[model samples]
Structures are given as C-alpha cells and as structure tokens.
Target: MASNSEQKIPTMSRQAAEALIAEKMGPDRVPRKFKIITDTSDFFRVDYNDVVILGDNPYWVKRYEKEGRFGLDDEPKYWVRRAIDLSDGSTKILKLVFHEEFETKIGGISIRCFRSPKKEARILDLVAEHPNFMHGHWVLDSAGNNVRILEFIPGPRYDQLIIDYGTDHQDYFFNYFKEVLDQYIELVTAIKFLHDHGEKHGDIRRDHIIHDRECKVNRWIDFDYNYMHGESMFGFDLQGLGNILIFLTGRGDVLVPELYQQQREVFDRLWGEDLNISYKNRVANLQKIFPYIPKSLNRILLHFSIGAKIFYETTDQMLFDLAKARADVIKLSGRTS
Candidate 1:
C-alpha cells in the first residue's frame, strides 16, 4: 500500500484544469465507427482499415513524453503517452503499438509468451469494475493498431514501499505482515478469477502492483502479455506471484556478503547447509536472515529458492499454504489477524 506521502503530487482548480486540458487537446474529430472486437480467437483475422477506431480519444500530455520515473515501464517509451480526458479532467494513458515476445522456462516448464494488445483490451473489459485491476479500454488507432486508454492510478508502487518502509523490520513482520498476507490472499484469489474465466495476467510483477491508497487495493497493471503452455500453463504468472511472496515474507531481501563485511562471525555461522537460499546473489530465506521467521512460511519461500523440490500446481495450492502459514505465524505471535 502507498505511504502517507501521497500529497507530494500537486493539484489545481477545476476551471484552470479544464482550460489546460482543452488547450492541450486541440480540435476534435468525429471518431471512426467500427465494431469493437472483444473476441480473442478471431483477433488476428480483423481487417486493418475497417477497424481503425474502436473507442474515444484523449489529448496527449507532452511533459511525460521524455520519460516516466517510478514505473516498471520499459522503454522506447514514446509508445506510452499520458493524456487528460477533457470530459472529466481525469488523467489517462494512451498506449500505442509496442509488441514483443520471448521464450522462457521456469521450473522446467516451457513458456511461449507474446504481447497481446487485443487480449489486454479484453481483460480491461473483464476487470473493468474489479478493484485489483487497473481499468482501461482498447481502441484501434488511425493506423488500425490496437491502442489502450488506461486510467492513471497514482501512488508509489508496492515494491517501492518494500524499499521505503521506515519502521523496524521485526515490527513490520510481527505486526503488519498479517495484513499484507490478507492482501496477498486477495491478489492470488483475483488471479484465480482470471484463470477460471480462461484469461491470464501475463505480465505480473512486483513493480506492476500499484497501491491505490484511497480504494485500498494493490492493483495489478500492464496485462499485454499472452502465452501458450502445456501442463503448467500458469507457471509464469505463478512465478511472478511467488516473487511477490518472497519479497513480502522476507521483508525485502538480505545481502549476506554485505552482512559478512559487517559481522564475519554471523556470516560464517549462516554459511552452512541450512542457510537461506541465495537468489540473484542475495539471501532470500527470511528464516536464515531472521531466524524468528516461522517454518511454515519459510517452507513456501524454499520452493522459489535455488534447488527446491516442490512446486505449486495451482493458485489454490498457493492460497492453502499461505493460509496455513499465516495461521501458524499469527498464533505464534499471539495476535488476532
């Protein structure tokens, strides 16, 4: 969730904002009439010229043209433009054509993933009112390319909060972690909702989760990816969720080498077989970093760790483990969650 420093962003009056919005948005043209394609199976078969425009347009905000700080947005970022809806003065994003794909493997499961703008557009419609998703609609641009008009959700990202938590680590763990786990349950459940509907959140990342403080949701964003898989179809999405769990339960990650520089004896003691899994050169096992970490939860983290045996088959399995761990930890803490 977002910290209390949200007021750092400035605001302006309605009249002035409207004037600026109109000034930025030049002359309006009649939007081309076309059938908005919601069906993903026939997405590629649609004619380009006939499907030129599918939704309303907004005026571009030129200032964010150069770059956007504090986002997971990868570049050649000119494809992503900010805009203001003249009708309501609400901020929106105009995403243009930027398709890319790759082949990757996680837990011996092969994943063939590609950017699916049409799929994303369809998902926007699906989760239009769902609090956990960033709301948007798809439009066909003048060039007949799939363009997205996304509502701008402003706040520091959940990953940012992970780095910026100001209190004692132990305090965050014993006191606040139960709530985060609850939130994670909500997130995992939301993902399951998508799966049950024959859809997937292809691009799930720690940075993609926005903490909309007012609505009090860790909203997921950027779902342009689609994939084909065999048995573990949701492997990529599950991996992303596992990454989030690791970050949350571990209270960020520990750099054992850094700790070694400070305390050689402690590092030496933590160097043996039961030491936490070192992920990306950092120790991911909260149990090793803070031995107070409960075994039930640490076991889940071990699956995401190096050389772990078990893997979660479904989101339901993950939820079950998370619930069990939360119960064990809450009981150990002697606190009601």
Candidate 2:
C-alpha cells in the first residue's frame, strides 16, 4: 500500500459534521446541501466534473468521523469517478474505499454487516476473466487507501429495465417474462459459481446487475458488502434474490396505490397474510392477484411468505426450484389464456 500521509482528506468541522449527520439520520429534520469530496489523483486522472458521491450505506460515516478518521475535510473521502488511466488511455471506474458498519435481519437471522473492499478486490481478481463480472484491478492509492480500477460496462441497470417494461404488466409478462426468468437463472448460476469457489457476492440488489448491451449479458457489480450470517453464510443474499424473483415474476408490485385502480371487489378480497412476509407493505399476493402466474412458480415464492416453514439456504437449492418453475411456467405460458 502506498502512503500519502501528506494527502489530506477534506472534511467538515466535528460539530458541523455531527449536526449535518444528525439531520441525515433524524426522523423529522430536512437536510441541507453539503459538499461532496472528490479524489482525482494517482495513475488515473478522474473526470472531476463527473464525479459521483455515494455515501456509506450502513451509516458508518458518523463513527469514522468520531474516531478522527475523517478529521476536518469538507466531505467523506469515499467516492467514485470515471478516470482515464494515464498509462493506457483507457477509461475505468475509480472507486475510493471508506469503511462502513450496520446490521440487518434476513429470515429471522441477525446479520452484522460492513464494507469489505479487500474481499471485493480479491473477487475482482478471481473474476477478472469471467464475462458475467466486471473486470477490475486493485491498487493502493498514494494515501495508502485501496482503490478499485474497474472496467465500466455500458447499459441500463437491471432494476431500471424491470421498472420500465413492468409498467404494462401484461405486455411485460407475455413478451419479456420468460426471457427475464432465463436471465435471472444465469445470474444466480454465476453467483453459485462464486459460492462454489468459497466467495460471496455479499450485496445482491437488482441494480447491482447491469445488462451489458454490447455483450447482451447481465454483469454483477459492487460485491463489497461482507456480512456475518449465523447459520446460512449466504442468507442475506438469498433474501435479496427472493425479493428480485418476486419483483420479476409479479411483473412489478401491485401495492395500495395500484389497488385503487382495481375493482373494489378485487381490493377488498385480499388479505395481509397473502402478501410477501419480507416485503409486506409495497407488494401483493401474486398467486391470488395474478392467477395466471403458474402455481409451480407461485409455490417457490411461498418460502418467502409468512406461513413458510423453510428458507432457501443456498443458491444451488434455489436454482433447483427455479429450474422446475421455468419448465412448468414456460409450458403453461405457451397456452392461450
């Protein structure tokens, strides 16, 4: 790791930072505009004008500040920029590291979580040649902090596509449904390959999967989340996967707002227990609401329901059911409704 004790991070005054962060986490207060710090040094020249500031997700910035890790700069040191690699003139993602901490519950399991850039760097090396993962190189910046130089994949994020086409549920269902399911299988299979190699994606949001338009494949990004799952090592990720399945299969959630558009009979007939256990508020009962969704696939979703007695422990196990659902649903989807 290179050292640049001389390279100072921009930060807010302790009192000011405390107040600003309090507003960020507070229930009632609206936050004021704050400066976002940008890093543009080293072997790569960051496009300073285009830098994007992504804050510590689990809210560890406050602690880092309390510990004097972020002493008196205008903002947090962690940020990303599109940079031109001075050596080869190739553009790459320059990701600055900032440690974070938090906790979340998945399937009744308490999982302690934090940033693990080293693990992500190692996985980047592991998937350097793999098509489904973004190619990246890790280096220590002049400040002795880890920096990831990533090959940027160009395309819409998976989540955006879901949200877009899913507006017309029937059209999305008939035209894109099978293809989405197939792509999801490929994604999970890629994840299973990582698990087989004794690694975890750690974070698995729908947005993390980017559809590489030129290559026509979904590429996974941002694997920095490292968590402590008690019994099932990949429990948190599995929950995320299940959530994605719910979103994809249902062709978007039919929540309270959408319910107003439906017949009063339709709205009144549904019950809370019929909704997904993990995401109760925003979505509805797919099996009941959309009876066209095959039971084969609907049964698989039940594991994430309130009445579930078992949860998927592994990607391979989830894939087994997915394969079965794929076969049944594809066959059922062929018929006239």
Off by over 4 Å in 2: 1-78, 105-110, 260-263, 335-337
Q: What's model 1's overall lDDT? A: 0.66
Q: Quote the positional error of residue 90 for candidate 1 in Å.
A: 1.3
Worst lDDT run of 10 residues, candidate 2, spans 58-67
Q: Tens digit of lDDT per residue, candidate 2, span 65-84? A: 11111135334333555543
Q: Each candidate's TM vs. the true structure?
A: 0.76, 0.73
Clash count list over all predictions? 0, 6
Candidate 1 per-residue C-alpha lDDT over 1-337 given as tens digits, one digit per residue, 9 for 90 to 100: 1011222322334344344444655424222332332221333333221111123323424223233333444444555666556555577776666677877554355668898777888888899989999987766543456667788887868777765553877877877777777888899999998988888898677778889987778899888888886688887688788878888876775666787898676677664333333345455565767777888998887766765667776898888888889898788667884
Highest-TM-score candidate: 1
Residue pairs whose backbone atoms clash in candidate 1: none
The alpha-carbon deviation from the true structure for residue 74 of candidate 2, after best TM-score superposition, in angstroms, is: 19
**Candidate 2: pairs in clash:** 10-73, 10-74, 11-72, 11-73, 11-74, 12-73
TM-score of 2: 0.73
